[model samples]
Target: MGFCSYKSFVILFCLIFTPLTKADLLSATLNYHQGSYSEAKREFLQLAHLGNADAIYNVAVMYLHGQGVEKNKAQAFAWFSLAADFGLLDARDTAMLIAEQTDNKQPLDDAYNALLKQLSFQWYDQQLRPELNASPALHLSPERRYTVEPKYPEHAYKNGIEGWVWLEFDIDKSGAVTDITLIDSYPEKTFDKAIINAVRRWQYQGNNQTLPYYNRSLLYHFTTYKGKQYEQSFKSQQREYNEKISDLIDAAEQGNALVQYYIANWLSSNDYNATRLLKYHWQQANANGELLLRSAVNGYANSQYRIGANMLRGKYGKVDREKGLNWILLAAQSGFASAQYRLGRELLNSQYVDYAPNKALKWLRAAAEQGLFSAKRDIALLLFDLKKPMQQVSTALNEALAGDNEHPQLLLLKAKIHAATGNSNDARKLSNSALKEAQTRNWDQSSIRHFIATLP
Candidate 1:
C-alpha cells in the first residue's frame, strides 16, 4: 500500500481504538481542514462515537470519500443521521443524498428528528409551561397565554367532516401569529384549507409578562357525534398521529399479514409519516387489512416486500433470520422486484445462517437483471468490496438511475467513482449535482457539503 493509504489506515485504527479528548478532537479537525484526511477521520470518528454530532457528520464525510476508510454509503448514512440527531445542522443537511437511494423516510426523518429532539422547541409543551401565580388574585386577571379555540361551522362538521387538523404556529413578541404550518389534517384538502385560513386570522393574548413567547401546537378535533353534534376541542393532535401511527405499528407488530407486509415499506418511504399525500394513502389501503384479516392475506407486492424486510431485520418482533429469509425468498420467488432485491440483501448479510457469496451474487444478479436500482447499487458495492471488475460496477450505477434521472445515491456513487479514477472535475460536478438534488428535496445538505469539501 502507498504511504497515504497506510497512514490513512493508521488514523482510522487510532480513531476506532482511542477515546477522543476535546483538545485532540480540535487538533484532528484542524488537521482535516489542513488536508490531513486520515488524521481528521480518526479524530472525527472518536468524537462521533462520543456523541458529537459534528464529528459524526465529519466521519460520514470520510466514509463518503474513502479518505481514511473504505467508502460505504450505508455507514456514511448511519453516521450522518446520528450526527444530525445530535443537533448538528450540517448532518441534517447531508442526509438528502442517501435519501435518494431508496424511498425510505427512515434516514430522512431520523436525521431531522435527531436535531429536532435536541431543541428546546421540540418539547415546547413540556418545557415551556404557563406559570401560575401563587395566589387566587392571579385567577382574577385576564387570560394571558394564547388560547386556541376552533370555530367549527355548526352544520359543516356535523354533516360529514371527521378527523383532526393540527396547526403549528409561531407566537410573535407582539402576540401576533406568523409562520403557520399545518402539521396534520384530514386527507381532504378543502378541510385543511378552511382550518388554515381561519387560524391565520385568529390572535391570542400573550401569557403573562415574564413569558417572552414561543411557538404553540394546536389541534382542532372536528368530530361529529350522533347526527348533528360538532365539537371542536383545543388539544394537541400530536398524540393523534402518534396514536394512529402507533395502532398501525401495533397491528404490524401483531404479525397481521397485511400490516406486517406494508409497515416496513411505509416506514421506509418518504411519506411514511402519514403525510397528506397519495403515497401515504396507498399505505392506508394496505393498513386497512387491520379490519379484515382474510383480506390482508392477499395484499400488494410492496406490502409483502416490506413484511419480509422487517422480518429479516427482526424489527417487528424476534430475530428470526431463518423465518425472515424464508418469507423474503417466497416474496422474491413470487416475482416481486422489491422482494427480490431484499432477498438478495438478506443472503448477502446472512453470516450466521450461512456464508454463501456465490449464492448472494446469484440473487443480486437476478434482482439487478430485473432493473432493481437498489440491487444494482448493492451489487456495485459488493463488487467493489471484492476488488474485482470495478469499472463495470461504476457503469452499472448510471444504469441503476437510468430513468429516475439524477438520484442522489447514484450521483454520489458517480462522484466517488469519478474521484477514484482521478477525474476531479467530474467528481466535483457529480457531488454538486447530488447537493442540488438534496437541497431541492430538503432531505439534508451536510453530507453533500462534506463530500464537496473533500473534492480536489
Candidate 2:
C-alpha cells in the first residue's frame, strides 16, 4: 500500500515535501536520539544542501541546544530563516521567536550577519567552563588514589615539543600497572616513555571486585616558560584560535565577568604563543589570577572554585594554605557541585585535622546529590578508602552503579568494592561485566584477566 512503507505518507501532504530525502531525515533523527549528534548534524547538513525543510529545522535545533556544535542562537535563527524561506511553517515560527529574542549588535553577531546580512544582536551567557586549569581533564578516567604527574622530559621541554600519546594498560589485582602498550604516539616517541613510566608508578587500591583492566588517552605537552615547567595546552598565543577561544578573548576584553573568568585560565596556559617577545606563562599567570579575582569578586561560584583549586594546586610561587581552603569553603557554601566534591576529596585526603572521613563523605554526598557524575563514584571510593563495613561498602557501590550501570570506571570500582568486602562471587560477576564492556568498547585488556585471577 506504499512506495517506502507507512513512512511515505508522513512526508506527503506534510508542510515540507520530501522527494528523496525522507530516509535521510529519519536517519538523522535516529542518530540525534542515539547521542550521535555529530553524525546527525552531518546528515542534516546534507539534507539542508538539497533544501529539505525538516533537515534544516533539525540543524537549527542542534545549534540551539549546543548538542553537536557550540551553541549559537544567531546561527540557529539564521538556519531557521532559511527553512522559513523554503516554506516550513515550524521553522517560520521558530525564526520569528528567536529573532525577537536576539539583537545583532555584538561582535559574535558577525557570523549571523554574514549569513543574513545586517542582523543585530545583544550579549548572551558569557561564562566559560573553569578554564583556570588545563583544558578539562580526561572526560572519563578512574577516580585517582595516587596520580603521578608525567615527568617533563628535559630533552623535549628544551625543544618546546608537544604532542599526545594514546595508551592502553591494565592494573593488576594489587593496583600496580602491568601491561602498557602505546596505542599511538604523536611526533613518534616524543613523550611516550614519560607517560608510560608515570602511569606504571601510579597506584590504585584494587579490591577483589575491581576490574583489573583499564584504559586511558593521555596528552603530554613539554613546555617551559622562563625556565619553569608548564604542563598545560595553552602554550602560545599564536596558535590557531578556534571560534570559541576567539570569542572568549573578545568578550573578556569587553569586560564580561564570565569571559574574564575564562580568560584568566587561558592566560595561565603555557600554550599561548610564547614565540612573542612577551612570553605568557610566567607573565600571564598573575594576570590570570587578577582576572579570576575580578570574576570571583562578582560572586561567580565557579570562579571562586577555580581560584581555590589553582591556589591549592600552587599557581605562582607561594601557596596560602588557609586562603585556598577558604576559597573552596566559599564555593562549597554557595552550593557548587564541583567545589563540594573537591572539598570532600580534600578532607578525605587531608593528613592534618584528624582525617575527617565522615565529613568528607557528607561533602561528597552533597556533590553527588547535585548530580555531579563523578561524585557518586567518588563516594563509593571513599567508603572503600575508609575501610568501612562490608555492608556499607556494598551499599555505596550499589548506589554508584545504579546511576551509571555501564560507566567503565564505575563498573570496575564496583568490582573492587566487592573484592575488598570479601564477596568473591559478587566480585567475579562484576569483573566479568567490566571486561565485557571493555572488550565491546574496543579496550585492550590482555594483561588484566591474569591479574583478576590472582586476586584474593
Candidate 3:
C-alpha cells in the first residue's frame, strides 16, 4: 500500500482500536463549522459507520473539499452514494450532479456500486450484527436494537414524490409494538401505510414490573431532491389563497362539501387569526356552526360528525339532542369510526336518549372492529358493568390494553377485575399504576388513591 498521510493514519488507528464515543451530529457539525475539519471528519466517519445518513453526507462533503483528507472525487462520490441509499435526497442529487459533470464517469459509477455493496444488509449482518447482539441496552427507550426503514412507495419514487409522516405508537409489556396511529402526514396518506407497517415490526425492552409505555412518537421523512419543489408548490398555493380568501368562500358557497368542511373546521379552532378567511369571519356569530351545518347537509361525513358532536355539547347554540343524534347516525351509517364511537357513548349515557344497551353495544363494536382503541375500552367497561362473563370482559380489556396499555381508566378497570377475581396482589399493583398515571396527567387522583387504599 502507498504511504498515507498522518491524518489518515490516525483515522485508521482509531477505527481499528479506539472505542467510539457517543458524539451527536450537532456537535460534529459544530466542529466542522468551527474549522476543526480533522476532528469533524473523524467524528463523521464514526457516526457514518453506525449508519447515520447526515454524518455520511457530511463525510462526503469533507472528502470533496479536502477538509481533512486529500480531495478525491471518487471517495466523495462513494460516500454520497452511501448517504443516498440511506434516503438523503440532497446526497442523491449531489452524486448525480457530480456524475454528470465528471468526464470519466465509469470509475465513479464503479466506486458508487462498490460502496453500496459494502453498506448493504449483508454487510450489516456480517459486521454490525454481532456488536448489536452483545449490547442489551440498545433495546431500551431512545434506542432500538433493530429497525426496518420504511420502503419508498414505488409510485412516489417514480414520480419523485416526497413528504413526511408523524406517528404515535405504544410498546406493550411484551416489548411488542402496537397502537400505531398516524398523528399527521403531509401529502396525506402517501407514506402512512409504509411507516405504520415498518413500525409494527419494532421491538423494545420489556419489563413486567413496570407498566407498558404509551404515546411514543416518531416523524419520518421521505424525500428526493430534499422536497424543495413540493414545498415551493405548497407555499405558492398558500400565497394564492392568502391573496384571495374570496375564492375559498366562493368554493364553499358552491356546495363543495370538502371546502365547506375545511372552512368550518378552521373557524371552530382557537387559531382564528391563522388564515385570512378565518380572520375575516372571526367576528361573525356562529359562522363555524353555519358552515358545518351546510357541509353536513352537503353530505360530508366528517362535518356531519363534528356538527353533531358540537350540538350535543351545546357548542353550536343549544343541546339539540334530537338533531345531534340524527346527524351522528348519518355519519355512522356512512362508516365513520369516530361517529360510531361517539354515537355508542351517547346512546349509553345521554339523558336525552333512553338508555339502549343493545344499540350502544352494536355501535361500540362497529368502532372497535375498525381499530378504535377508545371504542374497545368503552366496550370493556360496558361489558363489566353489565356483569358479563369474566372471560368476555377480560378479552375486551386485553384488546384495549394492547392498543393503550397506559390508559388510566383501563388500568383501573383491570384493577377492579383483579380484585373481583380475588387476585389482590395484582389488583394492588394495577391500582397503584393507575394512581401514578392519574397523578402524572394532573387528573383527579382522589378516586385512584381511595381505590388503592381499599386494596389489600
Q: Against the true structure, whose lDDT is highest?
A: 3
For residues 359-379, write the lDDT of model 2, one tens digit per residue. 888998998888665567778
**lDDT of residue 76 for candidate 3:** 92
- The predictions' CA RMSDs to the true structure, in order, are 27.6, 18.7, 24.8
Lowest lDDT sum, 10 consecutive residues, model 1, at 6-15
Candidate topping TM-score = 3
Q: How many backbone clashes does candidate 3 have?
A: 0
- lDDT per model, in order? 0.51, 0.58, 0.67
Ranking by lDDT: 3, 2, 1
The 10-residue segment with the lowest total lDDT in model 2: 119-128
Clashes of each: 15, 22, 0
Give model 3's TM-score versus the native structure: 0.46
Q: Name the better of 2 and 3 by TM-score.
A: 3
Model 1 segments more than 4 A misplaced: 1-307, 310-316, 350-358, 369-371, 444-456
What local lDDT does model 1 show for residue 278? 20
Model 3 segments more than 4 A misplaced: 1-250, 267-287
